[model samples]
Target: MECTICKMGETKASDITVALQRGELSVLIKNVPAEVCANCGEYYLSDDIADKVLTQAEVSAAKNAEVEILRFRK
Candidate 1:
C-alpha cells in the first residue's frame, strides 16, 4: 500500500516500536506489527492493533506510570 503521509513511499509489513505519550505519561511499546513507509519512516497500525496498544497505554496511565516500556504481546 502507498503511505498516506508520504506519497513518495510504499508501505510494507514490518515490526516497529511505537512511542505514545499523554499528559505526564510516556509509553514505549516494541515489536509491534505495522505497515511502515519506506521513505518517510511513517507507520500505520491496524484497528485491532491500535486498540490493543491504546488499551495497554491506558492501563499504564491508570497505574500512574511516569514511563513504561513494554513488549507487544499477540
Candidate 2:
C-alpha cells in the first residue's frame, strides 16, 4: 500500500519494534508485524496487533514493571 504520510514511499509488511509508555512503565515489544513506510521508516500496526500490544503493556504495568522488553507473541 502507498504510504499516506510519505507519498513518495510504499508501505510493506515488515518486522518492527514497538515502544510504548504507560504512565511510569516503559515497554518494548520486538519483532512485531507492521506496515512500514520505506521512505520515512514509520511503523503502522494492524488493529488486532495494536490491541494485543496494548494488552501486553497493561499486564506489565499492572505488575509494576518500570522497564519491560519482550518478544511479540501471537
Best by TM-score: 1
Score every model by TM-score. Answer: 0.95, 0.94
Backbone clashes in candidate 1 total 0
**Worst lDDT 10-window in candidate 2:** 1-10
Candidate 2 lDDT tens digits, 1-74: 88888788899999999999867889999999999999999778999999998999889998999999999999
1-74 per-residue lDDT for model 1 (tens digits): 99888699999999999999999899999999999999999999999999999998999999999999999888
TM-score of 1: 0.95
At residue 61, give the lDDT of candidate 1: 94
All-Cα superposition RMSD per candidate: 0.7, 0.8
Error of 1 at 41 (Å): 0.6
lDDT of candidates 1 onward, in order: 0.94, 0.91
